[model samples]
Target: MRRGYWLILVATILLVTGYHLRFQAPATITAEQGTANLGNWDFTHQGPVSLSGDWLFFPGQLHTPASFLQTLQTTGGAGRAPQTLPVPATWNKLYRHQSSHPLAQGRGYGTYALKLTGTGHSSLGLVQQPACTSSRSYFFPASAPSSQPVSTLGHVAATAPQSLPHQQPVFSALRTRPGAPHYLLVQVANFDHRLGGLCRAVYLGTQQQLFDLQLQRLIGQGLTIAIIFSMTIYAFAIYFYTPHNRSSLWLGLWALCATLYFWTRANFWEQAFGTGGTFGFAFHYTVEYCSLLLMGPFIIYFHHHAYRTRYVAERLLRGNFAAVLLLCLAVLVTPVEWFTRYYTPLMWLMLAQLLLAGYILLRALHDRQKNAVRLGISALPLFFTIPVDLFANLNGKPSGSYTELAMVFFVFMQGLVQGRRLGLVIVRSQHLSDSLAEEVKHQTASLEEKNYELLIARTALEEANRDLKALSITDGLTGAYNRLYFDRQFLIEWQRARRERCPLSLVLVDIDHFKALNDNHGHLAGDQGLKAIVSHLHAIFRRASDVVCRYGGEEFVVLLPNTSPDQAAAAAEELRALVASTPLHYHDQEIYYTVSIGVGGLPAPGPSQQPLDLLSAADRALYQVKRDGRNGVGVADVIAADIRA
Candidate 1:
């Protein structure tokens, strides 16, 4: 997939570059010794032609068309003739030996003159793009005696203050008359830039052709600006939504800088705001310099955020940011001439940043970081174009809009890389989602099985706990609740009865002559008799709230909630009769047992009445029953008074 994308990107770049080259104006005619003879040339058929050959140069002099014509007519083009220098070149590139006139050293006044000889009268248009620091051109017809120029761009003068620099594209129209030689003169002055004179080519064509060409260039520039600006918006949106990815922020900033810088280059500001005064010029240059200076830092920052790097790249990034910030400040405050002088150093700084970017990218690739290869591939065009543009600027050559095209290409490649990343993320997410669903289904079945096992274990544990509790509270021999159970349950019953204002009853039963029986019939007989008595007692007093406990050896007690003392005594008598009737058959002999019963109750227990008082009253009644006669029942009311006694 990656290789295919790379091939497509390479093919697209090649096709676009070829298309651009194919449309570029070709120079077919060359002038020698300040004259271009196009007697047989057809302007309509060949399209616009670049006036690229040698033109007569007069150094240290700014001349009008009339004065220059006068000088040529009087001098007869003999001694003291103007030295010939190539057009579409800066004065700094002039060789000392090539001209008898003193060189401007890229900072002086000069006049350029060209003579043209064409066949018939035709309407001609001169399209001058951004070429020099300041210049004015004139076209004079030799057929008329008047030396007045038919077209002019700006008020070009020898002094710096009088010269009005027109940086925007200029289109001047003129009509050629038959049987006349035409003169084209341009006066140029440079005091604010590193390289001066005509630095860009001038094209001459039919009026309609020139307008169409200018329109094409403007449309191209507008489209480039719009595309880059859209990328800026996209990057900013990403950054705003996901703040953790700082690369998006830096990319947005870099794209914004590129947009502004290119807008300035396309001279959109002059068109929008009109040809400005001193403040306007200063503002324009300041924005241009600041935008250009920030581009390097922003891109470096973007790279640093896009990939992790060693300390070297981080330090370089910070240093580049600080340097660019300072340069931007200088551009804001300083004059155009002062800041423009450092253009070379600024270019060098940008070059260093590009190298740093390459280093970081290579390291990322070596470490096998994500998107490293994509990013490196996308950066190729920018890397190639920037250095070429820098070289052209340094050598004072016209470095057209190749950098802009390269930037657009780079952005397109980056978009593709980002799109691929998003697609992979979506695919991986879908796979993971499916896997997660399957895992959840399997885990849910396993959990249900484990829960069923746990339910069974819990049921068994509950049964065992109930059995243990029963054993803890029950007497082994009599199968009745033990004294410990009675001690705890009596208080709870008393409290509940007191709160509900109900009667609480206790019945005490003692087996008569138990020791005598044990002595006569042995301990086995005694145990069997006790069990028989307890069974009869439970059968007689069988209520949900009734409690039966073996108080001690041969003694049993029964507690009944919501029962009166009389009712409890009746129940106790019934239990005694039942005990007498029921006997245990041990060793084929029947063992009979009789129990003396006592009843104690509180119809409405007082606040001061304690649970132990009822037990004491019951004990007293039991003693009374034993003293009177065995197997009989007795009752004791006033439990609290008895406890006090």
Candidate 2:
């Protein structure tokens, strides 16, 4: 009845209020280049709302990062004439950049306006398309490949008259063939961000459904492969991250020995593995390989950093980065075979690093915080979540059992554990408070008669109240804060950040296809998986200031204080990969589960400034991660992007 209860009630009310506010308003976005004219588009964000209309997109020209950046930099800000560019064609060969190595100018820059009110045919084509060499397409980030060749003409003209009831902002398109038949149909309220382009779909007669099905199939395939990759990685992670945390270079290397997945993801991968190659090879050589190499040391350092083993970890990181960078540069100019030779040590280095991380954690348990011990104890059950069928999957064993009863059981258990974690926190808190009160009452000289008894009662009540206050938001299953707690905490943090003019970050963790796991395994195994995760996360995240909480259902949230989006992303990625690498098993089934994370952060200066925007941004980023294929992290900032509409 004192200020305590009032404060708690007020806090709870405020949080609930904020939850609804989140869905109240849309984030304003600014118009940019192609987006400057779109009429039928939606504003679902707070930053730049470029031309994401019912229009056509002159997909990017293929250029090296340098040239691409130059174009962006030159035309990015305001008050600049649009560059003269061949709509969808690259300047790679035209500019004689074949020998430019990693610095080739292959990007497209420019915008064209158009309008589509009815289902009419209109052709927006390109001139002088790049030659489609199978090798070239494999390694590069291709926005759109030329489906067919276009004829180049001296000039092109817009024959259709622009007519509409209102002067509406339309959309942009790429280079059009001087003469070609093109038609587009724009539908109202059917705005989609699926690759956000004007003339997003080709109206090929009544066969539109076929294209849609094909597109969906392609996406489905990518997703299928990604899920497999994630599962494999997750299984390996848990297996590698045993309670011992000792070096397992041999095992880790064995797991990662295949380049098939990596190659499949990159354009250059096809160059090396594909029948004919080297067209899309430059980007892979310079950027992609270097990126992997850079990650090697970090992986090693994280795994082995805790080890008493000193110089090897640091040296590995430095050397790996340097080696990869050099290799990347050489890849730009050198052939695949020559590059592969230098890349050999990279494999050894990666294996070494993974081993180091394992050892460091184990040793840290032995000589240091021993938190590793707690994590191990807590994580043992997760070791059981490994699907029984995992061995066959790894060994390329002909999926001996499609219907894995053991795997199903484990997933079921994980769900139960997750549910219990969510539901029992309050019951546990109450129990703890009651027990504490009883103990204190008995210990205290209650009823020194009446006066003493009254004081004792007051004390018991006070202690119980405090305990309940703590229990309200904490998750019973994983000791992390519950969604209720996380939301309240986020609001409070947002208020603080606003008042103090500081940064706040949110990491949203989603166990990949957890629903499938639940469907396969029983509820109990799912619960166990959740519990293991809560325990493991607690150990990895030792910072007292950080907040690890359960955010509704299977999603977990981590809030970092005074951290940027990138930092939050790095932290999330590390945790994700670590979770993936940790070997969790159950019964005969041994399969892995991965996570897709989204990070969002912003500067908040007051309570009046809502926390919903940040949550929305983070959610958008998370959505992007999932859409792009789960098992990764995406940090999106509408503000940094100057998004407005």
Candidate 3:
């Protein structure tokens, strides 16, 4: 594993080295020599010289370079002398002789004059400083000895060269013959009120060399963009797989902010999308402010995960996020001028944040947390680069995106730490899984034993349920089905008869003088008689489809499926005779009873035919037997007519 990590580190180093070499700038001289004898300087190998040093500075406005030179000669004996401010510096810092908090002093215009004698090149490249809202340069020679036309001297406007008249010469390009002294006047306006005017070195190089420098800057920015973009993608993927790791998510957002910061500063937005004016201005500052503000929380959260802290890191992380969010809102709504003024302080605040993060990392290192030392080692570049850039800008020196490279390197190292952590988690999980498998096997055997016992209990419960259901339908006294069972069976038989297209018969039998027998022979004798009749009923309803049930007190009902009315009436007569002849021997006494039987039948039940209706007809027939004479079989009128047929 250690070897793998080393291999990865070596590969990354090689890749970055290759990218740097691929887009490397052409070899050129620093040209930091003093402002004298520029004509003797070589234009090819020692390309552009840093035009840094003392220059004649005129605040407010001086149109023509001749006017600026006149102001310089007199030295203003009675009035204020021309303030000798340094070139390649913001007027905000240099104008009042106060060097700090230049933006708070605010907006103005200035003209800087420098004398030079150089041989004519293809062109003189004029690079505008970032803070200069608008600028124009006027070129002059020792004598009017040039092929290019020189316009009549007039008030030199501070507008761009594109807006100037064609006759007048501008500093977009300065053509000259050898051995001629050239005086250059550059006019700059500070509309933004902060970091105003050229703070970077001016270069005088061949057109081809200047173009190569521009290309090199672009290629380097592109490479940084690709590097940061990949880091963002990797962070997001890690967050997606492990949502609990908030550090990964914050790192992704931080990487995204870094990309946007470079994009805005590198002027890629204008080149790709043509986004200019107020929207572009707003977008650039918003991105810049957010990128700076977000760095604090990202570092804190990363430390919270990568190392151990005393819960203070969590609070810091939350506070940092809230502060960044508020700053984002301020950057969006506040005017660019106001924001630019505060940008320096905000940068200082960021430097302080960097220190705080470093303090937390140092604590982690003290505690010897996993990967703490490696992570600190990786972030060393960022710690140095960020302050370097901040101080460079404060001192009015150009510090290209060295901080961006530092951030990429830091994120790459964090990613490696995360990968190592994930690897450890996977190994531990595999070990736990093996233990869990054994536990599951034991639980499975125990569960099977319990399940077998449950199956036996379930079977016994089903049988008990069936016996209880039978008891619910059975009559308690006579061991016959009660009226409730009769009603249910009547419907079943009626439907079955209809389906089979056969007649269904119902015979209602009532014991004659049953109430009198109950009064004289006592209820016990009556119950014995009922049991005797039930035994005869069971014999009569021998067929599986036939049902016998006690309709009510002293009332018995028999259901004969697929039986005609004639057959039903005949069966009822036999039941009546059986009751009259069979004697119930109770307490050494023989008791005889007769029954009045009624028969009702439906020839293939229909929709109009009902089970209750059929039972009612049978009841009416029994009433007729009671009305005429007791102990006789009676058939319904419809069944009697069918039997006659």
Model 1 lDDT, full chain set: 0.76
lDDT of 2: 0.45
Using lDDT as the measure, which candidate wins?
Answer: 1
Model 2's TM-score against the true structure: 0.28
Model 3 residue 211 distance off true place after TM-score fit, in angstroms: 0.5
Worst lDDT 10-window in candidate 3: 162-171
In model 2, where is the ten-residue run with the lowest total lDDT? Answer: 188-197
Query: How would you encode candidate 2's per-residue C-alpha lDDT over 1-645 as one tens digit per residue?
Result: 245534754553354334333322122223333222223332112211211222222233323323433554576575564433222222333344465532123222222222222212222211111111110111111233243222211111111121011101112233322223222212111011011112111211112332333344334334333433433354345434342433223223322322232333323243334422223333444444454445445444434532344534456557765765675576667644345434445545555554555555556666654234533343233233223233332221212212222222222222233233333554665576667565545434324667766755575556455656756776655556888888877878777776676778888888888888788887776877787677666666668888989997788888888887777888888888887887557776765888888888764433434677778878888889999989898887744421233
Once fitted onto the true fold, the runs of candidate 3 whose alpha carbons sit more than 4 angstroms away are 1-36, 65-83, 95-106, 120-124, 140-174, 308-310, 313-316, 400-402, 422-645
lDDT of each: 0.76, 0.45, 0.68
lDDT of 1 by residue, 1-645 (tens): 578777876775675566556546655467799998867778878777888789988878877877887777766756666688887888777653456444445777788888988835478888876655777787877644345554444556777787665667789887677557888887777776667887878888889988888877777777778878887987887666456678878988999999999888778998888865455566777888899889987887777778655525467668768878987887888888788878888888889888887877777888888888878877877888999988898778866668877887877776666557555655765565554444333323325767755644443334333545655787866768899999999889988888788889999888899999999889988887877776677678878899989999888899899999888888887777777787768888887778888888888687877887888888998899899987788898665422222
- Report the C-alpha displacement of residue 223, candidate 3, in angstroms: 1.5
- Work out the TM-score per prediction: 0.63, 0.28, 0.58
Give candidate 1 regions above 4 Å deviation. 1-19, 26-28, 95-103, 119-121, 145-151, 309-313, 422-645
For 1-645, candidate 3 gives per-residue lDDT tens digits of: 377776876787566656666544333222222234566677777765556677666667745655655665566555665655566676656654554533336455667666675555546654333434445566667464232323221223443232111111122345665677776566666554356654545555666666666667677778778788887898888787677777778778778877887776676776677655445645666676777677676776666665545536457667777887788788788876688778678888888778877887888888887677878987899899989998876655656556766776776777787777666766765555544444333323324767755644443334333545655787777777888898888888787876777888899989889999999899999988887888888777788878889989999999998898889998888888887888889899988878898999877777556677788889999999999988999998663222321
How does candidate 3 score on lDDT?
0.68
Best by TM-score: 1
